[model samples]
Target: MPNAAPAPGQQPAAPLLGIGQVLARLTTEFPDLTPSKLRFLEERGLVHPARTPSGYRKFSQNDLSRLKLILTMQRDCYLPLAVIKDYLADVDAGLNPPMPGAALPGGASILQTGRRLSREELTREAGATPMLVQDAFSASVITPAETYGEDSLIVLKALVELQRSGIEPRHLRGFRQAAERELGLIESALMPVARRRDPSSRVKAAELAVEIAGQLEVVRSSLIRSALSRIVP
Candidate 1:
């Protein structure tokens, strides 16, 4: 058991908050956050709130800061929990850590942060013509969104360069299929963690899936590099 609440003369060092308040405070920036997701984060040992005498959760300011870090990495950066976990562990230990959502070495990052772009802005930034944009979208190389993201601009820019090499979106139709196949493999490998219905298991499953995908990416890149090693420009 812990010390009883201080008498009327004194308040705790900081006010403690209920789960509802935490959700309300954070939901504007993290719309997908829910009671279950908070519980999921708890189960992963990312944020530990204090327990009331009644066994209810009570979040402190530090807890809120930790949750913000976790949610920002997940939503804005699409970081897998494992990477975020390592980052947080170092931070809690009072060390400087590499930020999350960086690309695995020798690979491209799948997510980005910054201003959202309209179609025209994306095309302008990528220096791509309307016809080329249509071709990329039609090939499903980049999914359409009301407002495009940085990744969309990157893909479009690459398509522009590849176009000058006489390679077009049609030549890259297989990329999507390859991605789906790799995803299927990762999903299959995640069956053990995915079978449980608990929040902890769900979080574990997500991290495992990303780890598996990262491994597959390394292997794919190794093969590509090996194949290119023998080629001459």
Candidate 2:
């Protein structure tokens, strides 16, 4: 496995890890991650791991850190690729710019905050009640989990605010259905690569799905804005 952080007294001349090694390091946190997904991220210039003479990928410590940040933003913040790419551009340039939709430092904040959180801890951090959390799971706003991820906290917070405005979890069921429809569209688009039983093909398929999801988010946002413009003012 790739060590995203160097061990003390580790050689400065250490060789970087291959794609499989990087996957081994990241898969526990990003279970759905694949080689294709990593390549897709590279295509968008989110993280540029080095290539060997034979064109094999090699990931460095910095590359792993950047990838961890990218996945965190996607899974936790629900950000689009464009936004994450922009954030990565800043971080790569040595800037500590504020993370969009986060109260913490850009990319660096995740170092302090680990992935897992208990249900009570989640509710308290999101400023939500126990009842609201139960309601959210019951309405299928978020899948039930023994321990919630940071994304759950973010969603719960948003639900709390919506509830105050008379927009309860039940009111957002359509959003979940729409998400499933979008996921189906992504799956259909990746069918060619996804059908291949080889490891490389499987990786490529995962990456393609993420790229399509980003474009869909842009379209979804545009439609929402267009509708709001007609209904208001």
Error of 1 at 48 (Å): 30
Estimate the TM-score of every prediction.
0.54, 0.56
lDDT by residue for model 1 over 1-233, one digit each (tens)?
A: 99798889996788899999999999987665778667767766778999999989999999999999887776556577665787899998999966756665566453444357999999999999989999998898988788897668878999999999999998999999999999889888888878889976676566556546756766788899988888943
Clash pairs, model 2 backbone:
36-203, 36-204, 37-207
By TM-score, who's the top model here?
A: 2
Model 2 / residue 6 / CA error / Å: 38
Residue-by-residue lDDT tens digits, candidate 2, 87-192? 7778778999677657565655542454678888898998988888888998899888778876687799899999899988988888889899998899889998
Off by over 4 Å in 1: 1-114
